[model samples]
Every structure is written in C-alpha cells, then in structure tokens.
Target: MTQNGFEKTGDDALDAAFAAARAARPQPSAALMAAIRADAAREAAAAPRAARPRPAPARASTRPWAGFWRALGGWPSAGTLAASLVLGIAIGGQQAVPLAGLDILAPASGPLDEAAVADLLPGIDAFLTEG
Candidate 1:
C-alpha cells in the first residue's frame, strides 16, 4: 500500500507510466521565453526617465532686513504695523481731551468743592467724619 492508502496492484504497465510522467517535467519553450523578454524590453524602453534632483537655491547674504521682513509676515502685515504705529504716535501727541471729558491732567478752575469730591468718592465723606 502507498502512503495515500492506494493498494499496490503490482501492475508493471501502470508503474512504468507513472515513472515516465514524473521524469518528463513540462517547461516553457524557447519561443515563449524570447517573446517575454521582448515585451519586457519594450515596456522598459517606453517608460518615462526619472528626473535628476536639483540643488537648493542659494540664500541672499547681502540683504539684512530680509529676515525681519519675513518675521513681520511679509509686506501686507509690515505695512499694517507701520500704519498703526504712525497713527498711534499721531493720536498720542495731540492734547485734545478724550471723549469722556475727564482730563485729570488739565488745570482746574479752583479747589475741588465738597459736592465734587463726594461725587468722585461716594463713601469718602462718611470715612472722613468717622476719622
């Protein structure tokens, strides 16, 4: 009996046939191998060539303000900052009273009256009397 549980009939003809089949292994013909090689060669030739890597651009060494300009978020942001700075300076330099009409720095007509001081500090009168 064989390993696959096939009983050995002891047939010489069948045993010879199996031996011949195992010995004659199928292989690709030379014509098929030549055609495959031709196809591979054609595909490789038709494929696009790989591009060479380019060197990095050289940095500007002469311009010192280039870094500062870039840090300020380019031209639009720099222009805005400059305009804001100029407007702030112009407004701060003026002596005009603000919209609140309470300029502590402005000269007064005379000494502060009781009512005026009381208005400024609501609980000041009671604290002063207790003291």
Candidate 2:
C-alpha cells in the first residue's frame, strides 16, 4: 500500500527504534574526558620540537678525476701499464735514446734499407759453407 508517508508504519517505526537506541548510551564521565584531553596535550608536548638535520645529506664522496687515474692503469687486454710505459719510451723516443749498453754486433736502431731486407730471407748462401 503506497501512501504519501501517511503510511506511518514504515518511516515511523524506524525513527522510533533509532531514538530508543540513542537514548540508551550512558554519557561519558568528566574524569574520562579529562584523561583523554590530558593524553592529547602530553603527546603534543613530547614530540620533537625542531626538525633535525638529516646527516648533512651525504655529499658525493668521490673526486671527479678519480676515474682518469684509474684509466691510466690500463685495461687487461690492452697490456700492462708498466710494460706499455717502457715500450712507449723506447719506441717513441726513437733516435733520442742512447744505445751504448747494447751489443755492438746488433743491427742498427733505425729502419733498414731494401737491400738489407733481402739478407733476412733464407737462401743457399746462408748455409755457411766453409768454401
């Protein structure tokens, strides 16, 4: 049966039940309210007063040029840094290097002539026949 809320049994019954339940709750005691207020106040006071400086924000600990020195140490396949240094000085130093300590019979320090290179190829002449 639909009516313009003249049907009291529907809305009226719900309102009355809610009102009855609301009336049954005991009022909070003043002592309990005071304790809750005291807790909130203590919490406010106990919190840290100022923001602490967070470990001075860990600045970059490495120097920018560190990798350049590491690169000079040389990579594995490229050859040892120590060996390369000696070889570079010997090769790059060229005619400037003194050869006094070397054996006297050794070939000269500079590039050889075309005729001299023909001497390196093995031939019957290299057999060292005592004739």
Candidate 3:
C-alpha cells in the first residue's frame, strides 16, 4: 500500500520493482580474486625474513621546560651544567674579594685617581695655556 498525503492506495508495483533490482546485483569475478591473492603472496615471499621493524618516533613534551632540557641533550646536558656549577662554587670560595684590606685613605698614585689629578686641578687654566 502506497500513501499520497492522507490518501492511501493499495499498490504492489513498488515492492516488485525493489525485489527485481536486488536480485540483479553483480559480484566480483574469480579471476580478479585470484590476481589479488597472487600479488599478496608474491610480496610476502619477497620480504626479508630478518627485516627489522621500524622504531617508533620520540614523543615530544608539552611542558615549557621540556624544550630547555631537550636542547641541553637531556641527562648529559644536566651533568655538564651541574659540574660547571660545582667547579665555579669551589673556585669562587677559594678566592674571595678583599673588601676588608681596601685602603681608600691611601695616596691615589694610580692613573685617573684623585691624588694623581689633585696637584694639577688648582692651576688647571695655567696648565691648559702652557700646553
């Protein structure tokens, strides 16, 4: 039964057409299947028995510090940085700044010091004219 809007009509033509179409469906030929199987077999036989599987790609980290660590070559980088830090601390401790022995009151006999220019500052214009 086929219905148009609210009206219904008793019809068997639509059902028969669908049944006929379904019965006429095509299938793959035997030759096609044989060719596909032959290709698969040939490829399998040609493959090396001792062929190694490919290694999986390294997973990159999403953390901000991960890039920093990776750039330093991971554990080796960390060890180098640690060694440098330890050596720096050891050397620094051995040679300390001599703040206590600094003599600010002593004569500034060195170049560009106050004592070096003190004697020449009073007669600055006379010195300049003489030059």
lDDT of each: 0.77, 0.65, 0.71
Instruction: For candidate 2, list the clashing residue pairs, or say none.
Output: none
Best by TM-score: 3
How many residue pairs clash in model 1?
A: 0
Evaluate model 1: give its TM-score: 0.38
lDDT of 3 by residue, 24-130 (tens): 87777999999999999998888886574767678767999988888889998899999999999999889655576445434467546655455547777576689
| Model 1 lDDT-worst window of ten | 98-107
Q: Considering summed lDDT, which 10 consecutive residues are worst modelled in model 3?
A: 1-10
Estimate the TM-score of every prediction. 0.38, 0.31, 0.44
Q: Can you give the lDDT of residue 131 in candidate 1?
A: 78
Tens-digit lDDT track for model 1 on 1-131? 66244444479788767666657968889999999999999988877665434566886657888888878899899889999999999999989756565654333677667777787789998899997
Question: How many clashes does each candidate structure show, in the order listed?
Answer: 0, 0, 0
Error of 3 at 83 (Å): 0.8
> Which residue runs does candidate 1 get wrong by more than 4 Å?
1-51, 58-66, 93-95, 98-115, 127-131
Rank list by lDDT: 1, 3, 2
